[model samples]
Target: MNRRLLGAVAAVVALVLGVGALFLLLPERGQGPAAAPASTTSAPATPTSTTTAPRVLVDGPVGVPTRIEIAELGVDAPVMAVGTTPENAQEVPSSLDATGWWRDGAEPGAPGNAVIVGHTASVDDAVFDPLVDAEVGDEVFVTGSGGTVAFTVERTETVPVADFGDVAADVYRSEGDSGLVLMTCGDWNGNSFESTVIVHAVPTGA
Candidate 1:
């Protein structure tokens, strides 16, 4: 996220000064309460579309670095997943910047939305940040233990945080297209309930 777009959050945490949270810029995730892996060692991220298990976040569990390849922006970075509730959303760095779309609801290629998040403001947006340029017909892929799930970029838009809270049908819903929202700084002003940058995409194939 550009400093100007980051707004107050950016003001408080500036990458310009190189004092911002590096973890914050690392793409993150947010899902409903669910038991998952406790914790694990982190490995380096590569360009290989290898599907691997994710590291666990045990109580502020560090989000595993799941690589994201955006063919359009040429972005490649590891996106982190976090729990959606207030208790965990901010706790996960990956989720804080560009949190996960939430998996329990729908499998990437199954149906519903397959969301993911990451910081758009990075020294070099190798991953989640590139979503800013993602437009309809673009592609976003995530490699996890299950496998590689690719999503076609539907469109990008900002919505009230409250509305994004449990997406319904019309508000934050998309059936004609797979529902994948890569949310980020939208208001670039408010600290809360600003706006959400939604990069709509669907699973292309494995």
Candidate 2:
């Protein structure tokens, strides 16, 4: 595929797998987070009655994400907006301590999927290393200039690089309720990551 098309696909796939060539150069630390044990099905589970709280709605205009926090994982990091690179790859944060939010995608607590990508590991500890320990029902809080939106971990999936294009379509879909997608490289195989780990979340009133 052409670079532009590939980049677009990368953005979508990154929503789930945080695919990036740079990550390959970094030394391996440990295995990527295993898929949340609760996620057994291939498809994302629809939010059911278990979510008793009303979905948090944007009070006014959606704000750009400024920070992301996962109490369960003890993650508290700054966020920067980023787009695709000239090579047609999704742009990632330069610092391992921060994360990059897809500028063209939905803002948190808005109408569509908001994607955040971070490195799984770097020479020093990376921002998202703790993601490998994430589980369903974990809470992800995204702070914006406007306000904060809370999301509940819905599912996690690990897919091969070759198959990410198909999965990307679903991750980037905009028809559903406001959602969050976290992506990171998964399963290092010496030269490159054999797969990508994707975490799906939905806004919860809390």
Candidate 2 clashes between residue pairs 3 or more apart in a chain or in different chains: 7-88, 33-132
User: Can you tell me which runs of candidate 1 are displaced by over 4 Å?
Assistant: 1-65, 85-91, 94-104, 122-127, 160-178, 190-193
Model 2 agreement with the true structure over 34-94: per-residue lDDT tens digits: 1211111122112111112223445432477777889999998878777644433455676
Residue lDDT tens for model 1, 80-191: 5443332122223332233343432343444445445444443443234555566788876665544555566756776554444333233233234444556553443422
Error of 1 at 83 (Å): 1.9
The prediction achieving the highest lDDT against the true structure is 2
Residue 120 in candidate 2 has what lDDT?
A: 70
| Lowest lDDT 10-residue stretch of candidate 2 | 36-45
Error at 63, model 1, angstroms: 16
Best by TM-score: 2
* Candidate 1 Cα lDDT to native: 0.40
